[model samples]
Target: MKNKILIWGGSLLAFLLVVIVVLFIFRSRVLQYTIERVITKVENKYPADLNIGNAEFVDWNSVVLNDISFVPHGLDTLFTTDSVYATVSFRSIFKGRIVFKRLEVSDGYLTARKNGDVNNFDFLFKKSETAQPVDTTKGRNYGTLLNRVIETAFDNVPDQVDFKNLNASYKSPNRMIDVRMPFLRIDDGYVESQVSILADSIQNNLRVRGTIDPGDYNINASLYAFDEKGIRLPYVKKKFEGEVAFDTLHLSLTNKRYRNEKLTVRGRAMVNNLILNHAKLNDEDILVKESAIDYVVTLGQNLFEVDSATEVRVNSAKANIYAAYQNKPSKIYDLGVKTEWMPANDFFGSLPAGLFENLDGIKASGELKYKMKFHVNMDSLDYLVFNSDLDASKDFKIQQWGNTNLQKINGSFVHTVYEYGKPVRTFTVGPSNAFYAPINQISRHLRNAILTAEDAGYYSHKGFHEEAFRQAIIKNLEEGEFARGGSTISMQLVKNVFLSRKKTVARKVEEAIIVWMIENLDLVSKNRMFEVYLNIIEWGPDVYGAKDASRFYFGKEPSELNLNEAIFLTSIIPSPKRYRSSFDSYGNLRSHKGYYYRLIGGIMRRRGLITQEEFENLYPNVKLYGRARDLIVTAPDAAEEDTTEFELETIDLLDF
Candidate 1:
């Protein structure tokens, strides 16, 4: 048996030696056949033609290709290079896969063109809708294209890659750009590149340096983008370090899925002299002298936290913020913001041009200070609660109301407070005679009840309620509809008095701007703003203002309104035109509305607006009309002129 084993081993060894010698003698022919097969496969799979001058194995471990050119099937050459070469390790092939030591490309040019939505190069990879039937084996696998390429070429990352003298050009319907990279070097997982880019009207220079560790799943990168004049663009001059991973990966925004992963980034960002294109601020772009921020942000599986956020301000206000968002069973966010004293006018001046048409028109000067703590559930924003305060060192004044300004607002405003399709307002507010009751003159009970129902933070916050708005957005997401009216009394007043009844984003922004002016500029006292709101708001159909609403509903003066009457009045403000729905045919309050009335009454009582005895004695069965003789005209029709057109297109649908 031992002799037989020796003979068999000797024969195997001799056969292996012969096979190796044969392979070595025909190595060049084998390389030629392999290169031809690769070229044929590429041509068959892509809508493109390939050209090659020569392919040679420069040494034992290197392959070089010369005069390579590629063109889309119907278009000009997309890319051309004088030479391309790759050096690999032969020993690593015995372990498992080939490992590249170095790759170099010389004197390459790439061009891309787009006409409308279609591009010349897109046809090379993107299949045509009416293309012929494809053989699965011959077609490229797009779904795993990235993985396949990475697996094949980067099974073991290359030690270094160098590209020299590369020029890239892109042409689109709206713009043309040229990019030149004199040299690009990637070594040991670190990349360093410098590029000069020229566009139709802009010239930019960019330097990018980054390190990537795929094994550790981490990356650190910095980019600097500046114009020829050395001005940094907003997206330029940024440094980011983080770890990211995606689950159920998809490139589409709507279908992408994200898994909870911890990402922590610490960075300082800057944008010198950012310009915004807008028509309203003026015909020219709005120039922001400076905008920057330094922050530390951490995101966990179901939570996001910003531990420090400091806005860099040179000629504007200084603001700092700390915020966190968590979604364990439900989503919640807590944010604290503070702003130091700064020029109020400068703050507005920094906003979009024409967004606030006249800055100097409202003569105001003061240093402002603001502080706020906000917390809310994203699930139901209407139930949000918060505390905030905004004050100035000295009260500023608006001496003049421009033609497009808020003070020029003068007219008898009529609101069809009820009925969704009813005309809610008419400009021809005749005989602006609705009795204006001061905050002190109005019943404390009514004031407290209204606050409890409408906005509990009315006196404490500025024109905006962040928590409520955030909650509204969260609840909107859940319901697939906007079911909350996250407006504060100040916002409502700005919407009613100074702006049109149009429900639009522009209107909302303008309303907030006006409110900021009113609050920050000290244009009016909080009590005065509230009084004006009560006087101008539509309490019911044709019911304009609180005094009219009081007389129409309770047959009493605003100051004489009791707790129950006050709650009922506040309850209908959300849907005054639909107020009749809360009452039965006999004019008795509905059971559900009665429940809401009692709820508001209880809150008012708990808030000390009404005594415990009054709360217990408060009856929810208050009828809208006591008797036929007691009924008074709540909404008196206003006189309309020829130009005054009243059309009801659903104003307020928020449920309080």
Candidate 2:
């Protein structure tokens, strides 16, 4: 039995040696045949053409190739190379596999082109007929899958790599970017690259140096721009109509561990001398000297979370943020931001441009702390939680104003209203303007009616009405759109006085901050703010202020406006430009409006702004006596002048 076993083992060893020798001797022939089969399969599967000069194994572990190119059908060449050489693992070759250990590429180019919405590189991601549709409703085990993918990708990277004289270009209808890398090398996972980039009208030189450890799953890299001019981001200018640049960007992945079905990744991301600009943001560039986020990310079964321990620093401000998103059981989102007690100036300076325009360049004293918490379940939006506040210390005080002064509303000042970025009307907010009326000069009924129609809590609230804002957020989230506004009487006044007419989230935030400053700092009296709101708000196509509104509707002075006329004017305040729509073809107010009129009048009567007799006799009837009379159409199409949605929205938003 022992002798038979020895003979069988010897025969098996000799046969294996003979097989290895045969594979090595005819490896070129086998390679040529394999290449032909692969080319045929790829050509049949995709809209791409492949061209090659020749491929052969030059030595025991090296393969050299010439001219290779790949072009999308009916488009430019996506990639082309003059010559390529690689040294692969000898064991892998013997195991019928080719794993690259070293690589060198000389003279190559890659390009992409996009015209309008058409692009030449989109086919790469096109789904095939056999591909299965993604089912996002089901929970995914991302931690395990992602860890495996990372390990596989890193393991595949060549230990040594070199690229000489490569050019990459991207052209679009709006912009073009050309990149030239004279030399890029990686030896023992130490990387260095010199890149020259031209982005449309801008040119920049950059250097990237890094160390990568595939086995340890660690990487540290830094990007530096020559001349300290910052590396202007490409394509963003054309895509978003903005310029984003950074002087130095440092990134580090310190550790990643997978345990107990959870993956934790810790990293540091930083940028210095960041510059941002856009017309909607600010006329001048918004600059940040330094910003960084030291983050710890956790991924588990159907869950992704940014640990609360993560610290974020922007300029002189510091804060901690925690966020989590879950897709199992029910789609849920949670976010929290807790800011340290920072200097008032530092806090104001950290506010993003456009979002906090009113606080820009504002000088302040004392300390400010802010905190916000938000959570929502997609299945039950009504239960969403949102709480955000600024806790200013007692020592807090505004030392100087920013873009616009809140105190300017206290006294007579020229107020200009803009429409579509153009100044449409310029009028004084005080008595100097003929149309401007004081709080006493304005009719009590008109003032009361406007208050009831817009914000009944205008007198009690300092600047914001939390209930209204909460409802606005809930409704907006439910509809997945900004279909409603939570502006208070104070907010409206500040928007008209200190901000633009453009309706945007940024504008709303700025308006809110300005209103808060004005109310909290006691910069303007409630009476004066209400008086100014009555003086500057748009009343009709070309009319403004209460005096004009009273005259336009009833040909009466501000004090002469009656209850019914005041209600009609107040109702139109929500949609002044479309005020004509309030009346039907015969030029009479719609009957449905009477219901809201009585509802608001009831609130007014209870507040003692109007007598019981006035409430009982109230009617939604008013005659247009000024130029507004010509705006009413005798033969109006209901759809052309429909204001039902706008009216319902305004009435529902009324604080009363």
- Candidate with top lDDT is 2
* Model 1 per-residue lDDT at 466: 77
Per-candidate local distance difference test? 0.62, 0.81
Error of 1 at 448 (Å): 6.0
Name the TM-score of candidate 2: 0.74
lDDT of 2 by residue, 1-656 (tens): 99999999999999989988988987776666656876787787668998889888888878877898988999878889898888867776565546667889899898999887678777765546687664555666687667766766576566898989989999887678899999988899898998999986788899999999988888899999977667998767777898999999999988999998799999999998888887666655777788999999999889999999999998889999999999878899999999989899988888755456666789999998888898989898788887878778899999988876768777899988898879987877776787878889888888888887788888898888877777788899888988778779998888788887876556766776777778887888999889888888888877899888878777789998888888888887877888877886655788778777877887887778887777667767665665666667456443333333223222322454
**TM-score of each predicted structure versus truth:** 0.49, 0.74
Candidate 2, 257: how far from true, in Å?
Answer: 2.9
Tell me how far the alpha carbon of residue 123 in candidate 2 is from the true structure, in angstroms, after superposition: 16
Encode model 1's per-residue lDDT on 1-656: one tens digit a residue. 99999999999999978866665565556656666766787787777878888977777768787998888877768889999887756654333334457889898898898878767676544444575554554333332333233233333344588889888998887668788998877788787777787764446677767764545433455556543454223222122211111111111111111222244555555555455442322333445555556666665545667774545453365678789887766778888888877675665545544444444244446666778787778776666666666666655555455445554333334433323324545433334454655556677777787788788998887678877776676666578776887889988887766555555454566676678777765667787777767777777656777777777776678898877677778888888877666654444555676567657766665566667677666765543433311332233341221122222122121322
Q: Residue 323's C-alpha lDDT in candidate 1?
A: 92
Off by over 4 Å in 1: 1-341, 356-366, 369-391, 394-452, 455-488, 499-522, 525-527, 547-566, 602-618, 621-656
- Residue pairs that clash (backbone atoms under 3 angstroms), model 2: none
lDDT of 1: 0.62
Error of 1 at 121 (Å): 17
